[model samples]
Target: MERETLHRYRDIIPDFDAFLQAIRSERITAVRWNPHKVSRARLIEELEECFECVEEVKWYEHAFRLGYEEKPGKTLHHILGHYYIQEESAMVAALVLNPRKHAVVLDMCAAPGGKTTQLSALMENTGTIIANDKAIPRLKSLVANVSRLACLNVSITWNDATKIQAKECFDYVLVDAPCTAEGNLQERITLMPRRMRESLSRLQRNLLAKACELVKPKGIVVYCTCTFAPEENERVVSSILERYNVKLEPLKLKVPHAKGIESFGREQYGCEMRKTARIYPHHLNSGGAYIAKLKKRG
Candidate 1:
């Protein structure tokens, strides 16, 4: 683990010691019920008989927190695609997008399809979701999961999202851009090299810019990352705000989190940075995420 890299945010991250400890502790297991397949009550009742604990996540009714030892993948419910085992915090971006039924949406970097499936459930399989991913290897899981979850609305596409030319077509766009994965400290934290950091930062911005272009007038775009790096989160957002005609909106989540720092080191992101949300592991006893919601001008 690169403590030095993460320690740089000590001043911004609340309860720094607790944040560090929380990341080091075991990650909680969480699953979202597939409303398209099974009723929540029935799933909960069945899950209770197998796992020693089945506590629901307060903010999200469809999700539940299980004990550390609960291997949800090994259960029949998972096999039947009645539920999906996802990192609790990963569920937020989809809900934040909150797409309407029959709307056209895009998951810019959708792979391993957690958020895509969730969005399908939220839309109740009524909309068109172009779940695009660049890598072929990752698409295998993306295809499988979408199929397993019976997401009839999702259509898989292989493309470099930065080059996607579907301009002003989608009602909503989600840029769950790939990042350093610093938030998954429970597994391991890889030291990000300067070259890699610069590369990823550029990629994140390009992907976001493409999302802005792809969304219709007055549409919504949600940019999310599992890393805490400002270069990838707020900095990328700030750059987009400067170049695009979009407005930042405050995230109203029911979970514990800190507002995005307006200024990190010498860079100033302005007051709008406060509208973004940063979820640390300590906040949900799960993984961490940085989420920003933007609405395009009509």
Candidate 2:
């Protein structure tokens, strides 16, 4: 945990050990992302310095390059498909989901195509990816992004994840299920609806069940969320473990210049928690997020 974050949370949990212990217990609390240095200009500056993907200038400007010279977000994302403008936290889910190049995968709630597109990149444009979303309009966006990225292996579906029950159809499944957006309150302030708190848990339960059903036996199923609620995070995960024949896969998340997030969920929640990773804002210089890797057991 970051010092600032610990300071903000010291009243509730005294030290890093205590904070983690609490998380292991599944006591609902807010997590802080570190460095907190996600300015639009900073992201652009970093992207520009990297020469590997020069074609991404258009994506840089359109998707999220807030520091465009003029007319930011006009048609640049469409023109180049240089990269997908996605939430920094959201990317963690895909990386941790750890798709192999030849693995058949399913992204249950792929829309605006962030994770779907990233999977394409991870697979180096190989294998089959079935990206499904509930909204027809969003599916179109996913299609456009996939097409623009020149990924021929991806297929888009506009249907609720709950209804799709292809048994053992994929080597892996990513359920970046929708949540209350509590972890994003600091960034996406548009989460102004209070009524959603009551309904979000139920929705998550529905999504988790469906995701577990679609995953193949002995395959990996990753459950991720951008919220900090236990009902949505640890509780949903535990419920799945209890209700289904699945086990948690602890993720030692790795990225360039990225530190690993610790698992406090094991002891705190009265369940096997190490199989999943929980990230908070104070853990690193990014947004608050909770990620758990669950694999179907024999």
Candidate 3:
């Protein structure tokens, strides 16, 4: 991690040393049980024989925190669509969205389909989910995960999400926009260039705007990112609120989290930006993530 990047989060993140240490430490393995394929109790019973540990996430009944050595993916249960390997914090977006059964949903940038599959599971495979992504190669993995997870209701599309020509088309929309991956330090990835970060934020703003356009009036759009940068998280959301008739809704998850940054440097975001949730690695002993729930006004 660069000193400059670390400095940006120093004040905004409480216990900065702990935050740094947490990211530098080993990443926790977590997975959400696929209710479409198996019951949580049954999955646990099956996994108990293979792995030394299988513990349920207290707040999320379908999610479980696996022991460090457990490779949930290697098991036959996973091959049979028993569960999906996902970060603990990353699961919050779909849970907060709480899509109704048979609702039409759009997962903008749905490559690798973690949340899209979660949305399918939440909807009980009854609703339509347009799982669209721009990258063709990544979309292949998305399709595979959707198939392996037995997500029957998702229709995969390859396109620029911001260019989608639809209005009031979906009951719910999720803009899990592409970000700098600042929060995914578990992978030990390099810091992205400033230009790349700026470009991503621009794309994020456009995708979010399109999401607002596609969702029905009074519908919900849940914006999330696996990055801690305010530019990509709160600022992108702040700009959307300025252009759209939408209000930030409180995320009522029970996981430990910090409130979003209202201002970074001299730029002050909307007061409602505080309603967004920021989860640091130290907060949940998992990878960092940001989630903001928005409801379109009638």
TM-score per candidate: 0.97, 0.70, 0.96
lDDT at 180 for candidate 3?
A: 87
lDDT of 3: 0.88
Q: For residues 200-291, what per-residue lDDT tens digits would candidate 2 score against the true structure? A: 76777778888788878988888887765555677777777889988887677652221222223342454465455656544432345778
lDDT by residue for model 3 over 189-258, one digit each (tens)?
4567778878999999999999999999999999999888888898899999998999999878799999
Candidate 3 minimal-lDDT segment of 10 residues: 1-10
Q: Rank the candidates by lDDT, best first.
A: 1, 3, 2
lDDT scores in order: 0.91, 0.62, 0.88
For each of the candidates, give the backbone clash count: 0, 18, 0
Q: Which of candidates 1 and 3 is the stronger one according to lDDT?
A: 1
Which sections of candidate 1 miss by over 4 Å? Answer: 1-3, 187-190
lDDT of 1 by residue, 30-57 (tens): 9999988889999999889878988988
Worst 10 residues of 1 by lDDT: 185-194
Error of 2 at 256 (Å): 12
Better of 1 and 3 by TM-score: 1
Candidate 3 versus the native: TM-score? 0.96
